[model samples]
Target: MTLFTDIGALVASAIGGMQADGILPGGLDLGPVTVEPPRDAGHGDMATNAAMVLAKPAGKKPRDIAEALAPRLAADPRVASAEVAGPGFINLRLETSVWQEVPRAVIAAGTGYGRSTMGGGRKVNVEYVSANPTGPLHVGHTRGAVFGDALASLLDFAGWDVTREYYINDGGAQVDVLARSVYLRYLEAHGQEVEFADGTYPGEYLIAVGEALKAEVGDAYMGKPEAEWLEAVRSFATDAMMELIREDLKLLGVRMDHFFSEKSLYGTGRIESAIDTLKSKDLIYRGTLEPPKGKTPEDWEPREQTLFRSTAHGDDVDRPIMKSDGAWTYFAPDIAYHWDKVSRGYDALIDVFGADHGGYVKRMKAAVSALSDGRVPLDIKLCQLVKLYKDGEPFKMSKRAGTFVTLRDVVDEVGPDVTRFVMLTRKNDAPLDFDFGKVLEQSKENPVFYVQYAHARVHSVLRKARDAGLDVSDTALAGADVAQLDHEAELAVAKKLAEWPRLVEIAAKGHEPHRVAFFLYDLASDFHALWNRGNDQPELRFLQEDQPATSAAKIALARAVSVVISAGLGILGVAPVEEMR
Candidate 1:
């Protein structure tokens, strides 16, 4: 159990006693009440805002409630002192024994230490990296992939039944461009020179696809008309591109539970069914949208079209779902796809989109709301761009991707663990400057290296203790007499360890896996601080010669830090290194 939550329960129990004794009114809402660490360490170990939140409702002064509650809380053996601080907050200093139990609890739980049941096993589908079936995934798509995968793992750790999904955008005109590009490569394989036009892809990656097509059908469509070979080439090209995308994802340690094809929704009545579901609710209609607010486009023209009344569900205005030519608009398939997700019985839906798709957020949310009838919640996270640098200069572009840096380029330079960890060092919506030179440095400035170094140091401590004939296994450490870990520096690390469960629940609830990375960094900082302090104080060291019991106690604390670091790294899809090279 989490120490914060356990202390919160104790605070609630004390308030309940106050209500029983008629010191305060009954039936007060304690939802806003929280027990967390005090802002100032000298104030107390933990602080609660129960009195401040209850003052208005109970019609009693905050100090009156806090003064009455303090005695009841101080009565518990676990509480060393329960002092009323400031106006109403009750600051509690728990017994040192309470903090010592953190290491023991961590040792007992192992990698599962911070896992929670906060989700209650609700279903959530996280769709990310739905880049078009173009060549390889670029750095922009890489950020979305890492964010979405980490979010899914975070939700799973918080006890949600999560499905990791990728929406293949193969139904658009881009795939047709891809097909034409591959046809050029196919023609080149037949020894006929072909020049790539403005609209077709000219990336070097398409060369292999062209040769493969030539291998499959020798010169069959060599001089055929566009219509005669367009469909065949499109199918073949998209499959090949999707295979390339899958390989890129696999290299980054990302695996999708499902890949929903946009092409599958077309001609399968899925789009019609989804629109019909909305039409039944009067969300579909015939209309013409007003000119957009900014400078009117040169092609701007008012034309009657099939529109979705997205404003009814909080969109800025109605959106077109079908063109006058009876062809489905780009929005139609997206609406249908989200409707498909809603129809799958998910309690929640999350889309991880690149920053360029920021404009689609409100409309997509409106579509899901109208389709799900507001039963399911939808959250769309936008991942900003990643700018690569090497030696403090802008990194070069990938020759294979032609226009941008590919995911493979980054992962190949720095391993997947480094790529994933460094990608999450910033918030999803913030621009990240990935410096190839800095991330590999073995210094505190590099978060990935610093955090991994802490873990490695713990193993070093364990190894030294083992060589000294000390039993430092997790089983032995769990039963260690941790009362010897009474130093303030040692207990400081234990306090940080106690924050793990609460931090996990908070990060999962907020759909911010970056918070996990930040927390791990802070935890590593605390661990490193203790390790550095040990250098000056012999008794503060983890492996105390001629004192096996004290060494076990200190090593148990070190092992707990490693456990938490490993668990946090796992959530970020990073492998913890035992020794840094």
Candidate 2:
């Protein structure tokens, strides 16, 4: 259960008691009141700002409000003491038994202990790793894939109906370039030498696609004109590249619920329908935009074009939907894609874009806002670059990807678990340095290993307790005399366990799955600290020689730590280890 939320409710009830006793206004606003852990643990177990936030609204002094509310809170059986601190903040000391029960509750719930209902089953569409289907996925795309997948898992754990989606960029000039490149490979498969032109892909990864095309068509299109084979070849190359991308994602444990094709928006009346909806709202117009910032008017060319009044919805300027050549701009299909998502009635939409696309943020949000009439909210999370390091030096490019390191290369150097966990060890907006040399180390500096070691430690304790003739099953541990876990160090680990549900809600609300990685690191640190403390205090050890009940009680606490670690790692898409090798 959420201990902090329960305590916050008690604080609200105390405020009500004050109002009922005529010490404060009857209808004072208590919405801003909060109960949380004190900034300094030495102060108390928990703290509340109920007095200060209500002082001005209640027309009473801060200290006076706190004085009136303290006794009401202290009267609860769960609250051992409630004392007013500096400037009317109330610090609460909960009963020892309350903290002692946290581990037992964790054992009772197992890995599901931290699951939250904050989302209320609302639907969310998370679109990420929408790299163009022109080649294999690179390291940059790997970061986005891991971040988006972890976020979807975190939202799912927090009770949201999450759809993992990838928008395929298959409608633009890039796909045409891919078709020509694959044609060259097909010629090479036919024992004909070919040269890759300036605008064509030259990666060796397409050799198999070329050979497969040779097998399928048997050189029928070898001498055909561009119009006779462009469409079919484009379809073949796009499908093959997408197959490669799917395999790359599978290597990293990322699976999309849907693959939306940009090409489908064309020739299906969908693009026109979305633009027509905007036109009916009077948002479309033929206008010439002003010269861009830092550009002289002479350097800018103005033309009457189909534009969307994006400025009305918080964008910096209006955006053109169609070019002077009577063809759609790159933004036109993107707008239609998001429009399709909004029309599907998702409660919210989240796009995981690369940091280079930062300029498109406001305009895309404006499109969704205008299309949905502000009914759905769009959040765009941009992932910054990932710099890879190995052997104490920066890792260079991969020949397979031609210009950059591919996702498969990183996953092969270190397995998918290390690749995914290290990708999320930093904020999405912050640059992450992924060092192959450091991630696999057994030292505490590596968060992945640190968390896994903690989980393994608990399993180790369970095995030892079982060998000592103590019942260490979850049911047995959950039913043990948990009251024996009264030491300060033991209770500290339990207190950390109590924060799991709150941490889940916090991470889910911000759509930041990296926070889950950070929380697991902290939880592991606390568990490790307690494990070290058992060395000096023989009675503090999880296993006692003859006291089966006492050993079970302590093993319960250790097992609870493992349970939370597994749940946190599960959200991060990292499989928890049962034992360290």
Best by lDDT: 1
Q: How far in Å is the alpha carbon of 132 misplaced in model 1?
A: 0.5
Superposed on all Cα atoms, model 2 deviates from the true structure by an RMSD in Å of 1.3
Clashing pairs in 2: none
lDDT of 1 at 549: 90
Candidate 1, residues 1-581, lDDT tens digits: the string is 59999989998998898889998888999899998888899999999999999999999999999999999999999999999988989999999999998999999999999999999999999999999998999999999999999999999999999999999999999988998999999999989889988788888899999999999999899889999999999999999999999999999999999999999999999999999999999989888889888747675888888999999999898999988889999999999999999999999999999898889999999999998889999999999999999879998855567777899999989989999999999999999999999999989999999999999999999888888888898999999999999989889999999999999998998999999999999999999999899888888998888988988999999999999999999999999989978
Go through the candidates in order and give each one's C-alpha lDDT. Answer: 0.93, 0.92
Q: Give candidate 2's whole-model lDDT.
A: 0.92
Q: List candidate 2 segments past 4 Å from native.
A: 26-29
Clash count per candidate: 0, 0
Q: lDDT per residue, candidate 2, 1-581, as tens digits? A: 78998999999888887778888888877778888889899999999999999989778899988988999999999999999999899999999999999988998998899899989999999999999999999999999999999999999999999999999999999999999999999999999989988789889999999999999999899888989989999999999999999999999999899999999999999989999999999999999999989999899988899999999999999999998998989999999999999988899999999999999999999999999999999999999999988757996746477877899999998899999999999999999998889999998999999999999999999888777777788888889898999998899999999988988988999999999999999999999988898898898998888888888888999999999999999988999998898
